[model samples]
Target: MNDIAPQVARRVLLLDGAMGTMIQSHHLDEEAYRWQGITAEGSSEILNLTRPEVIAQIHRSYLEAGADIIETNTFCANRINLLEYGLEDHVDIINRRACRIAREEARDRAYVAGVMGPTNHALSLASKLEDPAFRRFDFNDFHASYLEQALLLIEGGVDLFLIETVFDTLVAKSAIIAALDAMERLSVHVPIMVSVTFSDASRRTLSGQSLASFIETMAPFPLFSLGLNCSTGPEEMIDLIQEMSETSPF
Candidate 1:
């Protein structure tokens, strides 16, 4: 992974677009995502171990297209989310290998961003709008899951961490805390980039926080960057990006 701070200081950095989108373009079937008699068809993360060349090719394509940062193929590789595919036990291998694939493909041409996505569940009360009090996992549970994944990403040699597709601020908070803790324990320091996803065109997270509120909540974290991703396209995001620039210190 290259030094990202200097690059950020110089000019605008082009982070690669959707990993899921690029993977989908390949049209991999169920067999492609399977390994050791375990078939996790929709789990793209499985390809990091089963079909690394597929992931490496995607990274290469983005780099060739002039992307500055190559995000890993570990979006849903966390233990909690992988449980859905009965892959709870392969979390470490999945995350570490994903990073390795991205890093090898990136070489010194681009940075490898360890992508940490929000899990299938959320800790925010409003996640269950009808039952605002319901909770599938608490902050501690989320923190632990992120911590385990973060540690492996670090060990796998990512240049930085990208907590992306965040629909819940609480989930983002947990991920940030877990990343910090993982760095401390591993004696490493890496920049953290966060990209929040609006639930809709409302410019608010699914947890029901406005962009302003989200900025205020995440203000204390030492984030490398805080901005928007997912939910909408450029036309809809223009105003939101302008608004974020005005309110966010990052």
Candidate 2:
């Protein structure tokens, strides 16, 4: 199947707005849904687990909102995050359901962006530069977790993968590599998009890398698109986009 993302990226793609904001508007209560799988009997996270219909409805709302790309609710659907809620066994189910819901909601009107957010693991520059000792976790563990999610999303017929809200470039690199590796393994030629969240003050990723450095570091990857998302208002995001447009290879 031909990938539609390359064409979309060439234009000014309109990604859906803040997910947390939209969810909050639902008044599900933050602590309740945030800790869903573990605390609440059928936590809001379990919406994918129990009420996938509701999830699809949310996706449809974004499409109606004029979003060219609608991300799946699987942002925190990875094994690590699921495990926190004692729902590790539901990782595959949750991710796959998320993709299915998004696909159903799009109805060919919009593209489904399989969402992958940062892992619960802590990321620090000293940890990245410090070698094995500084690092608190093993690379294999990290790769396996992400690879599982990416593979499932692809299998579920997601149009593209979006690695977003990344802070440390090192961790972001791990996610990028994992997704690429999964695509290679599955022989699925889906496009991948990587977006990092910047700190409020300097507008740089948590690893202290400038936008230029981030672009340079991610240049080798076969990314169909690269941009910033989350943790910034429209004005800051606009400036960051302009800076990236000037510096990025495009």
Candidate 1 regions off by >4 Å? Answer: 125-132
Candidate 2 whole-model C-alpha lDDT, 0 to 1: 0.76
Candidate 1 TM-score, C-alpha based: 0.96
Compared with the true structure, model 2 gives a TM-score of 0.87
Q: Which residue pairs show collisions in model 1?
A: none
Score residue 185 of candidate 2 by CA lDDT.
98
Q: Could you tell me which residue pairs clash in candidate 2?
A: 36-43
CA displacement after TM-score superposition, residue 46 of candidate 1 (Å): 0.5
Over the stretch 1-250, how does candidate 2's per-residue lDDT look in tens digits? 2377566669877788666566656666434443344553433456675666667667778888899888888877777767777878878887877877788888667788888888666545444544734655556767788889989989988888889998877777778888999889998788888888898868777767888888999898888788888757778788889888888775
Estimate the overall C-alpha local distance difference test score of candidate 1.
0.89
> Clashes in candidate 1: how many?
0
Model 1 lDDT, residue 88, Cα: 90
